[model samples]
Target: MSMLEPQAPDLRVQKWIGADGESTGPLKLSDLGSGPKILFAFQHWCRGCHVHGFPTLQRLHSALSPRGVGFAVIQTVFEGADENTFEKLRVNQLEYALPVAFGHDEPLVGATLPTFMEDYRTRGTPWFSIIDAGGRIVFSDFHLDADRIVKDLELV
Candidate 1:
């Protein structure tokens, strides 16, 4: 998941938080359009996600969306389902005041990590991935250089 090599991981979401900040029901990877999409994975209880990741995501959205870049937030609950419940999506939307879609991604039965972490080889929360217009990952990592990503979005 480096800038030189990006993977096309599936976007399997158990539920989506709509623009109105309400449940939109189950969704699949294909539901997201062919896009230059910025997907940030987070956990409600992660300190880094709260202090850094979410703010970066919000900033990126504010800066890049006018250029036609798509954005989404996925709460990948590898642990603490009680803490990272679906309600948090709405809470996050309201708290952040962002109207973009947010998702709930829980682990499959008998699995420990959620699908995003397992399928994308993500290390933990606060992970970010950028998908090209063709749906290929262009950047996937814990750190996001907003200037570089904004520059890269032009090519997509």
Candidate 2:
């Protein structure tokens, strides 16, 4: 899907642990409040996501989080994977401190990256969505501009 389209309004997510054993949420963009929330959907195995998307996500989180913007990430694994390769992928090494969840978790609601592509009609990784405190989506994109997100928040 092109980044310009609005995301599904009723999209729901759940909470679960990541490969690092940390608590994470299958959160909806609307649920983010008290300040703006930025959601970054990613997969551990996507090379572009790891090299470019995540680093940009980190920068956005670091700069905006303190200013009351919440950041969350979803790290997905393909449904048909063996333990060896899945175990080799690490979510903790990615440089952001946001809460994270994985597709393997029980509460995923089948919203993994592959599922999101089919369900949300998006084609790739690093899908970003910005939701306001009232739950209305303000901006959604496949590409993120770290400086732009941070700068925009300063104005809010």
Candidate 3:
């Protein structure tokens, strides 16, 4: 349930809001397909997420999506449910102009954090989890430098 590493992911994230601002399914990791993928977790109200996370992810997506990399965004609601409302999912997506699958992950019944946060051991907002084409979590952390990922991709 904890300590996610580089391996086939047992993705259990429940609920999602698709890119087009509509209710969507409980998204699975496989929904991103079999190519390399990036998941950006954030809170709608998190200042750092807007200042650093979104920009970093946007840059990465712009550079990598053309190369066949997949991208998704999740509002990992750990606090301030009032501010991190599900409606913000589309608001942010449109604001950022990120045309990719966006998700809203709230803690399940009786759970303290969302399934993705628990499974990935995410510390807080502005987190990035990178999975390789092999479905392995090659990188998971709060700070992700797009440059590093680009270099890593070039080497791959």
Give per-residue CA lDDT, model 3, range 66-118, as digits (tens): 88787888888889989998888889999998988788788989999987798
What TM-score, computed on C-alpha atoms, does each candidate reach?
0.88, 0.67, 0.91
Candidate with better TM-score, 1 vs 3 = 3
Which 10 consecutive positions of candidate 1 have the poorest summed lDDT? 26-35
Give the per-residue lDDT digits (tens) of candidate 2, residues 96-134. Answer: 444434333112455444444444444556677777665
Query: Please, what is the whole-model Cα lDDT of each candidate in the order they appear?
Result: 0.82, 0.57, 0.83
Relative to the true structure, candidate 3 reaches a TM of 0.91
- Residue 11, candidate 2: Cα error in Å is 4.8
Backbone clashes, candidate 2: 3
Q: What would you estimate as the lDDT of candidate 2?
A: 0.57
Name every residue pair that clashes in candidate 1: none
Candidate 2: TM-score? Answer: 0.67
TM-score for predicted model 1 compared with the true structure: 0.88
TM-score, ranked from best to worst: 3, 1, 2
Which run of 10 residues does model 3 get worst, by summed lDDT? Answer: 1-10
Poorly placed runs, candidate 3 (over 4 Å): 1-4
